[model samples]
Target chain A: MKKLNFGIISYAHPHALRYASTIAQSRRAKLCAISGDGANSDVAKGEAKKYGAKFYKNYEDLLKNKNVEAVYIAIETYRHKEVAIRAAEEGKHILLEKPIALTLEDADEVIKAAEKNDVKLMLPFNPRFTEPLIKAKGMIKAGEIGALEYIHAISENVKPPIFLQGLDMSWFLDINKSGGGGFMDTAPHGIDSLLWLTKSVPKKVFADIGAKIYGFPVDDIGTAVLEFKNGILAVLTAGWGNPKGYSYGLEIKYYLVGREGFLDVRTAYPDFTVYQDRAEKIYWDRPDVRGIVGSFVTAVLKDKDVPISGEDAKKNLAIILAAYESSRKGKVVHIDL
Target chain B: MKELKIGVVGCGNIFNLAHKPALKNIESIKVIACADIDGERAREGAKAFNAKAFQSLDEFLDLDFDVVEVLTPTYAHAEIAIKALKAGKHVIVEKPIALTTEEAEKMVQTAEKEELKLFVGHVRRFDKRWVQMKDVIRKRNILPMHIRKREVQNLPFPAHYWYWDENKSGGVALDLGVHVTDFLRWFFESEPLEVLGTGKAIKEEAKSNDTFDHFIMVVKFEGGKTGIAEVSWAYPYPSRYGVFYHHVDIIGKNGRIRYTPLDTPVVGVAKANFEMPRFSPLLSTFPDAFERELRHFFECIKKDIEPKVTAEDALIALEIAEKAKESARKGEVVRL
Candidate 1:
């Protein structure tokens, strides 16, 4: 199979570097171009150079490049809709970093642009790529853990100064740009993870959003209590200001208590540790651990739906947006999607 | 002197605490073999204790051993113990024998058929304070009892470790809650009639294998006796103090007893007239309790008297833990 040529439009998102590196190392994709604003373009250019790719000062220039068949948007949350629309218009496939957009309208705009252009749009919810998470989803689907009763999924980052800086990004801090703060920035991962693991969409959501810390204009902490279609209750808490020096961590715990027994899949981190309740030794050191970039490349090359598809990603965004709306209204919001 | 052959399965944090220390103390129990899917961890465990390591349970089970400690995660308790029992070896399993009542029944049945002694290590049952408390409860008609176990420290291991995995460790209820559950069931002498619980994970960026670090469970026993057990892995306190230190309250028909076992001693001189708060006497009953349980296991193997805390009993505790989790999830009363 021909290696698909790819371009990254922004290097400002902390995950941009990882996305770039992952694309560079992909067996099925080639790093072709990078585009970003003036201040970050230099760094993006340098990063692109390391990958032996061309760097463009503008999104149009990158899109015009004939070699770039697909564009991976790692820009600030606000730029997602505009850049994604432009990429889709140019007949390029897109792997958009999460949130899809700040609002339901903007998210729909991007989705529509992809539909209009007839291009595959992928939203990279990275947690779905982690082996433990994938295995947990499989187990739940296979009924290995029995019928799902409850899911408590949490992802907390050590609120280090560096991560706080990511939140401090003008666009990230602005509700108009970032949609909301930590809830919009990070909670989608948890939402997507729960939905994927349970294979159930939330029917109603009761959420509380506030600036527990960071003292930013937007909420840095939010909790969403979701009722899924299968009568499963899920609680997801996403926050910043966790002690730093730790990578982005996520835990998806499912309780499938039935007549026979219960099964638990405790994933400690993205990298290692898949624990069962009764096992003595934690299954650690997963060398073939799949991350989002690999999954994207494989999905595009294999013509398979990305483990977290654009639709799935949008549904998760709807849940987050609904959570925000519920928090704002101080009542339970029924999820339409 | 020939070393006592010992094989351990389940390479988790508990192995380091229970089996590791116990084996180091007993020169006779030579840890000859170890098994874990994490080959490196199994090797490290074997290296730490000077034993051979195997990545698969089959290979580990093939080895000749007088005793096998099933340290694998809690979900595998029934399968591993039953296999070890059928293999005709004395088995020591970690708490809450299985994830459900039926699984525990199968284990007991297998142990009975094989004529092997099965020891469920409710380690706190081996704690001195608990032993004293058990003695007290045995003698009195205790009413409402409260036991709180907290694990607030940043877990020494990642949340993805098997025990934190709901499938492996059965969440906080089966993993950590089971200890207090077993203690409560043994103390109350009755199966829980109903359970109510609630739990939430405070950390959002925690790993995928993690669950709610905070769990509060209220259990009502058959005879109008009720107990509450609250446990957490991310409670923001020191881990050792949370596990080793406990505040217990027993309200009886006649009198009430409040004790904080493993309390930090306060020593200071008063400038004028100051009264010292009375301190509970330092009780070093752990060694006795450990020796008693171990001797009982050995005796059960020889004399064939029913084990003190049978696998069936541990299963009952697990059933309570499961019901508590169900109640927590559903936010409704779970009738056991």
Candidate 2:
């Protein structure tokens, strides 16, 4: 049981901390090193010490480390391709944060780089690890609900990244860096879950994307209606449209209607509200992040295929890009992929 | 004190559930006669109101009624309303004034020529909750960025029922879609600029020449505002009667408001089922709104004022719905 030594590059994205914690707590993986953003090197150094991992000022330096077997790239979305290509060139298995890259061409090049280097590329979509949804997918496939007819999914956040406390996530509001605000950053998870559960491809998409609540340059709210090739119609509304008082950090809901029966799925089910003098917090009982990290580690260690491949994520990205195009042109755009 | 004698046509579900309950509370309006193609239903409805029953439209039109309530199927709305107007009677047709814009326009023209009142039942205008939502947006100067209204009806009718036929019911787009588009137009206070729609028939077995059982319509207003209207009649299985789910979510620059039945303080729990008791928090209590709408109609007739929901408003909603149907068929955006 050889433990995979993992290095995390750039703490710009908050999910980097969760990945670091999961690696440190896992039995078959170790947090070998961490690289910080140039402006926030001290915070990364503190985090590296907390996880008992070495720290590097530059992400390239962490990539150069001989002991690091795989790298979790959690930089800004704009730099995903560059760092992921570099990590692949370093002969390290890569677990890239979602969207794969900003555009389809960049995503294809990243996939090519991973294949050319013979390193595993995995995209961590935590919703794919949800237990009830996994069961629901099985039931749907098993003809428990009959043929699936329609799907209504909602993946909403209370506010944009800029409104996040303690950390400055304003890069998400910049169109150049994050591509789009809420739809780009928050919608991929639901899209990925839909792609994974249904195992179908979207043929056409009509979308309404705009900045509704917060007047950011990037769109904060978007809703896409997709018709899949399997005759399943899915309508997903994703973005920062929920109120600030919504305690659930990420509210993901799905309603699946079939010929015989229907299912209502809430990923954050079995959660409880804890009210205190400081703040009210909702604690979800599902340890989905740990599931994602553990499965990725096992896939790398056993030389097995990753649960969610880059190609699968690229398809999800295609649906998202098509949605943006549909919104811009005010027409139903056919997905080329 | 009954000043207006009302003759009702069509004794279907809507008549028994909405108009009947509403007409009960209006003291100024009297139901003098009832007409239906089915003699039994006509007799039953007439008995309920202690009014005379007529199996022929001509015989019913010959009666001395001041107002005609066209509660029949959507496709028959134009003919019945125009005939009622030509016979010197004010007409109050249910939502979706007609299946086509031309038919609706003819009805409007007939009303103008006859100098008779013609009201379209855009009942949400009188619903206290929706009216209050409009008030909040207006008084607070809230600019709505996106609004979503959804309606799901689990119709208990079999596959061969006329409601499933596009010719008679005008499908879900003209049937349920009109209610939402009209509400969105009223909420935004703007005309629809364009619409993109996608629809499908979830049930494999249904009688329809054309038209889907479910439709998702996106309307862009004159401003940058966006409205999403979703209507579904394709429930997998049927309940004893039926089931209805309606929800409204408004996202504005100033604030957000969500009105859903899940927030109701009332619930019904039986042996194996727990339900919201009411099909919709807005509609289950809609008898009050229906009463208000009827009272408004009576007041307009008495005071010589224009009705709140004019035939023009219903025409605009139908136009949007027709464009949505075209968009759904062509898989493209249809501009108004």
Q: Which candidate is the best by TM-score?
A: 2
Q: What are the root-mean-square deviations of the candidates from the true structure over C-alphas?
A: 20.1, 3.0
Q: How close to the true structure is residue A143 of candidate 1, measured as C-alpha lDDT?
A: 60
Q: Compared to the true structure, candidate 2 yields what TM-score?
A: 0.94
In angstroms, give how far residue B83 of model 1 lies from its true place. Answer: 55
For model 2, residues A100-219, the per-residue Cα lDDT tens digits are 899989999999999999999999887667766776787788887788888878787777553456665788888888888889987898898778666788999999898877778889
Model 2 agreement with the true structure over B96-186: per-residue lDDT tens digits: 8998999999999999999999999888889898899898888987778888898876666676776787878778888889999999999
Error of 1 at A8 (Å): 0.4
Going through the candidates in order, what fraction of the true interface contacts does each contain? 0.00, 0.42
Q: State the C-alpha lDDT per candidate.
A: 0.66, 0.82
| lDDT tens readout by residue for model 1, A124-180 | 775666655666567657765445555556554434234434232556667876677
lDDT of 1 by residue, B1-336 (tens): 344577889776667654575566664457788888899889988997789999988878888886788877677888888888877788888776776667888888887798777888766676766677778766765433332233222243455566567776676666677777787787767778877666655433233655765566666666545565656554332232322224454533333455543222221111113232322112112434544555556556556678767777777778888887887677555788
Kindly report the docking quality category of candidate 1: incorrect
What TM-score does chain A of each model score against the native chain A?
Answer: 0.86, 0.95
